[model samples]
Target chain A: MTDVVVAGGGLIGLAVAWRAARRGLTVTVVDEAPGRGASEAAAGMLAPVTEAGYREESLLRLGLASLERWPAFAAELEAAGGLPVGLRTVGTLVVGFDDDDMRQLEALHDFQQELGLSAARLLPRAARRREPSLTSRIRGGLLVAGDHSVDGRAVHAALLAAAEAAGVTLVRDRVEGVVVDGGRATGLRLRSGGTVPAGSVVVALGAHSAGLPGLPPVPVRPVKGQILRMAGAAGLLDGTVRALVRGRHVYLVPYGEDRLIIGATTEDRGFDPTVTAGGVHDLLHDAIEVVPGVSELELAETLARWRPGTPDNAPLLGPTAVPGLVLATGHHRNGVLLTPVTADAIADLLATGELPDRAAPFTVDRFEAP
Target chain B: MTDVVVAGGGLIGLAVAWRAARRGLTVTVVDEAPGRGASEAAAGMLAPVTEAGYREESLLRLGLASLERWPAFAAELEAAGGLPVGLRTVGTLVVGFDDDDMRQLEALHDFQQELGLSAARLLPRAARRREPSLTSRIRGGLLVAGDHSVDGRAVHAALLAAAEAAGVTLVRDRVEGVVVDGGRATGLRLRSGGTVPAGSVVVALGAHSAGLPGLPPVPVRPVKGQILRMAGAAGLLDGTVRALVRGRHVYLVPYGEDRLIIGATTEDRGFDPTVTAGGVHDLLHDAIEVVPGVSELELAETLARWRPGTPDNAPLLGPTAVPGLVLATGHHRNGVLLTPVTADAIADLLATGELPDRAAPFTVDRFEAP
Candidate 1:
């Protein structure tokens, strides 16, 4: 029997399985579409606070912790996979246009200060000074120093490579059910009428985690987002900037040599993920507002995607009610941010049969109604 | 005399021209590579709230206004081009897991309500009951009803058809510079040494607007975004659901027939629009968290593109400081959402030689102070 049977082959699952295999545990990851979930479509922004607003502190903490581990984790993955994961600690600048936006920034700054985290700093002209591409609409800004970013898709590829390199079996099959014997997960039943036994099972499904049977019910949901991309002169902006210009949330992220990353729109209307004229129009309009020079760049592509979300907006990690079933799903926006932490935590849990304190808050049991 | 000479053939430029032409004004459009740009790469979602929050009220207002006009605009385009623009007003839902996440939902609801908008609603358990696929772990949700969506690529095709049908001259050549007669814009100088004379000019170059010279400086900057597309079980999701999930900012948009739209990451490193391994991995991970059944889907495509950005994160619209040179660049993130408004506003401005109230806040004058 395999030491671990990962039900999904997403970044989280593969990272865990790869880490487990490195610890001399036999691991098998079962997924029909190995790299076609939310993990593949994500923007890979490793910002914990930029994504946090009201009370997603737990998730923010987890993301921050994972962000702390990203450098080392990415290095390890690179060593195993012989690839660069595009990990960078360039920091993020949250800029505002007017008084109301500055108020919002101040509130966020106060919250960050209260966390005893040196993640954000207020900027006046310093924001535009650091990145000259910024227009002189001249307003206040918040610089999140601790937060960094990575290429989510690259990390996914590296994880898959690392997992295979570490001798974890990657099987392509849809998991239909979990094989439970006496309230313990023994294996996973495949849709093709096949079963693979394991000493432990972990469900690392992203948005689709709810469809899997025989688990504590997960409140995972699908959130659709659309993004636009363009190609221009490289080195347009120095670091990631979340523009609070005119009370509109827009971002300009540069990723090596004439490419800029801008996105996205959130929508909830079932599963109609089609690129729309209105979506494209909005992206261009706002992008132009932030960097006016973008009007001259060549647009490379536009995309729409879905992100898997949990009830608390925190990932479901560590042990479940089932004895041998460990849950590692529900990492919505921070999947890339939490990748390193997830791999390390799941590996530690599988190795010692217990979760660390950092992962305790993200336990699947948190979803229980009680 | 033509009031504007739009210097691009993509959806944004064409839409502006189509609207301008409809306003009983002579308009000429020059394009090097028409029908490309973020318009080609976008998965259109007309969700202002879904794309809201970076404190982008101007863009949100613009998106809402355009969304209000989308149905009629799409119908007009259809009437002109004899093709459907794939416009649909399917609302969006932003869901949360627990009390902490509920805070974000509440904040969004409050903000929407404060905006005097009827598009958003706070959904309880009963609201989620309509879709059984939604996990029981949902704490609550916020639904944005007025937000709609469409297929951008389809609209691009239809816009070309409509533009040609609207008597707008479509020129195929790279724009070298603006032809200025007596310090007033007259036409475009092609890269092949051909000059196309016009009464005026509109620099609707999308991300590439900065590359052109002898026009108003748009200050357009390119932002890159990467995305992945997958084909899942047909009719997998009921509508679009976005989650401020786990500090990762993820969403799942279903585009009919088992195909789900998954995406994207924001990076500012410059113009290498190649699909990376990490992007695919992160997208898959997040997607599975919301819909566990997607492991059974197939990955159809992976894409990367750039978006144009401006200084204040708002688009530059209306007339420029240069005589006879109207500016319509710097539309970074809200290009798609602002298509209708942009088109109508440009048309009105061209016909009446006066800027509309909606275009006042997004003027190029805001960037002139520096």
Candidate 2:
């Protein structure tokens, strides 16, 4: 029997499987579709503060800790995968356009300060002068120094390679249901009618977690988001700028040579991922307000997807009511943000059979009513 | 003097200039990087109702008219450019998961019926039986017969070829400002300090119009989005499936034999166009949920871009307050959808200096405070 049978092979699941295998545990990840879940559709922004304000302080603390651990985590993955994950320490600058934005920025700053977090700093004209591409119509800006970013695709690739190197078996099969004898989780039944027994089962099914049978009811839901991708002229944008410009949320992120990442509209309108004209219009209008030069860039692609959001918007982690079944799903917006921490936490849990403090607050029982 | 000097050579600007030039009017288009912008990133989803909302009736109507004119437009463009824009009339199927989704589907169905439009139909079990690969979990679907799609990149390329063939001078110049003399539009001053004179200037700048100074204040905003381009296992998804499966908005647009377009997220985080971990995670999650077989496909590209949007969520077309400047900005998401109409409308206005009825509703006056 394997030490752990990861039910999904997305970034979260694969990372856990890889870390557990590194610790000399036999790991097998059963996923009919690997690397094709929320991991593939994410922008890979590692901003704990930028993504904060979801009313889950424990999850926020865990995310902040993961951000702290990201450098080492990325280095290890690079060493294992033999490729740079484009891990850039370039800070994210959140700028404001008018007075109302200033008020919002101040509130966010106050919240970060209350957390004893040095993640954000207000930037004046002198700081903005460092970046010449910034428009003249600037009020003030917030610099989220601790928040960093990485190439999410590179991480996914690295995890796959690292997991394979660590001797984790990645079986491609649709997990129809979990094999449970009495109250303990035993294994997974594949859609192909095959069965594989396991010492433990980690339910990391992302948005599809609630649908999987043999597990206690998990409250995972899908939140639809649409995005657009464009290729800019080389050296178009200098650093990451998250702007509250022209009364709209806009961000300009530059990557290697001529690629700029732009995005996303959040809608609860169940999984109808058609590229709408309205979604596109909203994106372009806000983008141009911040960076007029984008008008000159070539549009590379337009896309849409669904984020796996939990009721609380925080991921469910660690142990479940079942003895051998652990829950590792419901990482709504922060699956990419919490990847390293999740991997390490799950690996630690599998080794010790005890939940870590970092993942303690994200228990599946949070959604259960007394 | 030329009727108009378009400040960009993208599909939006060029199509407008081309239509005007075809109508026995002299036109010049100034573009630093022509045939780019969101036009290059777009998959050319000509879907109006597929992208419609209860409030977006006007935009939907405009999209429907363009969809009706698309076949003839492509044919005309092909005739002029000796190149084909891959325009397919294969209707889109918006798939649903369960009873709750059927309610949303019914609402959209009701909306379609109320419009007296026959382009959409409700697909039941009998119709869905034709496609066996679709999961049994699907309760029902909406068939948008009028909503079609095109290869947006191909259309952009074809437009360039067509524009060149139609005797329009495509000059490579970064327009600095419009040369206004005596409160009348004269020409454009280039970044290179050169000047080109014309009778009028049309700002069809897509997401970049907000930066061009000395223009009527048009509230253009940017909405960022991300997408993934995958190579399916030779005919994985037949035609386009605009899926509303389980509240995850996803589109499985099939491009030719193996390429499938899946996407995106709407982010108002300013022009940071980096493809994030979250974006990838969400896209793959929904893609797998909608079409369980997509996991086996090879991921070709993970891309992101920003779309141009307006306040009212509709495009700003027709005349501006500036005498020599005709405002054709703020098509936002429908830039691709309104390409034909915009081109035709702008060309008509340029030749006769009269606003066509089709372009009247989209006038800049709509945004002016009463």
Candidate 3:
């Protein structure tokens, strides 16, 4: 029997398994196809400061904690996996195109200032000076120097490699249900009709984590997002550019030398991964509105994926009602941003069977009836 | 020695070879990859009436002649190839978005009327009645009942099958130059260092027919065009929609049940085939402006190709200056629409050693300094 069994082999599950294995615990991850799902489409923006909201201060703190661990985490993973995760610290520019967009940006800037976040307000000219590819039509923007990005797909690949190097066994199969014996989660029952008993089980199936037959109730829903990947954008922008065109949100994140990820449209439709024409047009339209030079790049690909969303938009992590069962899913749009902290916290619990104090507030019990 | 060696395998060359084979003349076609180049991107708009220009009366006559032969040609080819060529007899609508566009359409309509073409002028509402998917912002339009369309790719595939079925040898090799001997065109020198000896050599390489070694000067320049292919537009438009959006021209041609071709931009950029962001943006912006519903269709593909353009924009379709050398290229934007007439005319010349009367006016000598 394995010491721990992870139900998904995405970035979260792989990272948790790797960390658990490093703590002298045997680990096995089961997934039909690992490193896919939302991890495949994440833009990898670690912009805790820019993404901070008014009432979601706790989520903001969690994002900052993960952001703080990214540098060391990336270095250690690169050394172990022998792969570069394309982490760039050039920061992000959040621009607004019209008067209404500027007003919203101004309000966000005030909130960031109230929270003592490190963001600088910039005029249209100043914003364009930082990223010359930006359109002259932008009204204003905010530059958060602490905000950064990485290539999410690269990170997932590196995590898989690092986890394998750390002696974590990877089972390429689907988890049909939690193998619960005596009201305690024991292992995973795979779609291939095989079972691997474990001392503990971690559910990390992203949007598919909800309503497993033998598991406690988990509140996760699929929030569909349509994104476009473009190429030939080398030196177009120094960093990421998130914009509000009128009232709609759009972002362009430069991944490698000439590849830019333009995204996305948030729809509540469940698990329908159809990349619609309106979604692409809206993304391209707003991207061109913010960065005019994007109109000259090659549209490399278009994809739609589900971000595992919860009611409060914060990830559900740590211990659950069922003994020997853990929850480390529901990262929503911040899955890539929170991968490091979620992995360490969940792995700590899996090894010692105690939820870390910092991660205790994010347990499933927080969402249960008061 | 073979009777004929055609130096391209695109729609024009394939059709001509098939027709010649049907006339009991042995033929061989040389192309590294058959039915590609501009043939792959042609929108297959058979709109001689609507495409009629003021100074292009001769070209208009040629297009009308080809359009007249398309029905019989498609039927015979489909019968021989055993494949449906997706020929739609639904007429074409040339619409206008603004006053300038409307005035341009009106002038073109006047020219068509003067040429005795079958076109009916329609008001905005009447035009919408014809194609309900057209945006209400259309100022006016002209409906040409005689114009029609076909699936260019489907036609090429069918032509390939028909040509092979007619005992035409398809040499999947590139033609390096015309094999000239004793001041007479004999055959073709292939890129594979092989020589194909023939009684006659037909230079049908489209834009690449201009300056081949050992061949007479054929004034064909590559006119770059970028186009878009979309899907999920099964019933978006009843027929083709050719629109003048502001001062720009955009056409939407529906082929199979759900595929729509949106095209294109005319650039004199020499043989560059990079599908730029500006090119796709312009096509999509104008397409959406003309038919708002196009914003909902999937952008299936984006491609750029070069059209063999001539000074008069009319194809050179007869024997050239070199002995035993025939010119059957330079169809420009009308390649697919002109395939039937060009094939019949060129095949007649090859089989009888005399240029057909209709194709005689389009010889390379027409552009002589005399």
Candidate 4:
């Protein structure tokens, strides 16, 4: 019998399996398209200061803690997988371009400072001196020196390799249902009508984790995002720049080999994978305004994917009502950002049958059935 | 007696002197400071496309025609002043961040297309591929490939030098009043109690134009703007990023020596030239969204100035009721943009004794006197 069956092969599931196997659990990750979800299209910005907002105080705290884990997570992944996940220690800059925007930024800054975060306000001259190409139109900005980034693609690759190396079986097959016997998760039903018995099961299918056999529908649904990448001369940007361009969440993250990633559109279109023209257009428009230099770079690729979102915009973690069943989905825009924390907590539960205190607030029973 | 006594030493006055002197008119620019005014705080965006709106067709036409004159104008100035006014032909990217922004952008795009302009819609890939640092959250964008920019400080210097080189006299004194003898313009009365007679007097005092002694109050008022400058390593940005960031005009213009210019909060606060903290905050916020790399750059300077604005947002040019007294102020945010055409048209009026057809539409009579 498999000690654990994680119902996904995306970052969260692979990470969980990797950790579970490290704790000596026999684990299997079942995914039709391995490593293809929100994680694949993420900008990988470990931005707690920029991502923090109203009604997300707990998530902000969790994200800040997760950001702390990323450095060690990347180091361990490199040691285990023999490939360095591209983690850059360069900081993040949050900026505003108008009066109203500045007011909002100041409010956020006040909140960040109140939280005792090491966020510093920089005048336009100081901000532009660091990023020479920065527009002089910037009124002022906040510098989050602690906020860093890891390459999303590199992280995905490393997790897959590290998980496999840790004796976690990656089954490239669709999950049909969960086998429930005596009010407990007994195994996973494969799309090919095969049954894999497991002592415990974790549903971590990202945006597709809402419906499962014998479980009520979760509030988790697909929120499609369109992200794009461009290649240019190296060091065009040394770090991440996140901003509310007219109240929109526009971020530019520069990664390995001169690749600049721009994203995403927070959309509620359920399960739609089509990359609409408007989504791509909005991204470019906002990006170019902040970085006029972007209009000169080379176009690389356009991608669209779905992120798992819950009503509260926080991930559901820990156990379900079923005795041996667990939950880890709805990471939303933060699935990649939350991987290390999610993996550790889930592995703890799978190995010791107890959820960590850090994972307690993100319980599965927080929301009603969708 | 000078054929033309320009009652302001800003770019419009200098450009007019340069042209009128070139046409063999005895031109005297009576200005306390020649290279100052709103032109000193300008980003020098020749952007009719981003600036056009309903009821602004004539100004748009005039702007486009002025944009056409820029190349030749720059060459002529370079020849006369021996200074290379940096004119970047890289174009302008007009961006939008969210759905509402996209809708507004699409409407502008539609209007641009209807006007038969060479505006093209750019996908995220194409846009980011070009700039590489552009944020992916841009909902949509249009490339106004013909809309270019010039360095404001360089242009200001060149205009002053070129005007002096073209046989224009620079009278460094404050014009206390326009001497409208027998209800016709004759000359200017200086604050120093010196009278300089001219065949015609052109009021080009920018935001300070309203308080002239004999002129009835036009609908022009002083609108204060704060702009900023930053220095960075070379090749940070290639062009200009203009956006209505949450309905406010925010622009990022890149110039020589890796200087990024961010600017101009449109406020009705009336002649206030103090740089507020909120003003700078908004610009950096919106600008950083498009170019995350900006945070790494250096910040240089913060500046505040007053722009002469009119009710209809168009300049008051050509003749007033006082025959030899012409109105040449109220260029608003477009003063630097409209310099060349304004110079040519005003020079034609001074030389030929009649307003050009293009200048006729922008006469002071178009607006009821306030």
Individual DockQ of the candidates? 0.02, 0.03, 0.53, 0.01
Residue-level lDDT of model 1, residues A1-370, one tens digit each, is 8999999998889999999999899999999998787776666788887766668787787887888788899899999998788876778888888898888788888887787766555566787777777767748777887667777778888888889999999989999988899999999999989998999998887777786778767777877766766676487776777877677677777665566777666666446566553445456566666666665565566677677777677888888788889888878667888888988899999999989899998897776779
What local lDDT does model 3 show for residue A40?
Answer: 88
Report the C-alpha displacement of residue A64, candidate 1, in angstroms. 2.0
lDDT tens per residue, model 4, B9-87: 8889888888989999988889887767787888888888778787789999999999999999999899999998899
Scanning candidate 4 chain A in windows of ten residues, the lowest lDDT window is A273-282
My TM-score estimates for the predictions, one after another, are: 0.53, 0.54, 0.96, 0.52
Fraction of the true interface contacts (Cα pairs closer than 8 Å across chains) found in each model: 0.00, 0.00, 0.47, 0.00
Evaluate all candidate structures by whole-model CA lDDT and list the values in order: 0.76, 0.78, 0.91, 0.83
Q: Which 10-residue window of candidate 2 chain B scores lowest in summed lDDT?
A: B126-135
Candidate 2 Cα misplacement greater than 4 A, ranges: A119-124, B1-370
Per-model B-chain TM-score? 0.91, 0.94, 0.99, 0.97
> How would you order the candidates by lDDT, starting with the best?
3, 4, 2, 1
Query: Best to worst by DockQ, what's the order?
Result: 3, 2, 1, 4
The residue ranges of model 4 lying beyond 4 angstroms of the native Cα positions read: A368-370, B1-370
What tens-digit string does per-residue lDDT give for candidate 1 at B1-370? Answer: 4556788887779998888887766667778778667776666777887666657788778877888888888898999988877775667777776677778777777777777766445565654664445556667777777666676777888888888898888888888888888888888888989877776688887777785778656788887767656665576666666765554655666664566676566666567666643454456555565555555465566677777777777788888777777777777766777888988887777777888998888878787778
Greater-lDDT candidate between 3 and 4: 3
List of chain A TM-scores, every candidate: 0.93, 0.94, 0.99, 0.97
Instruction: State the RMSD for candidate 1.
Output: 16.2
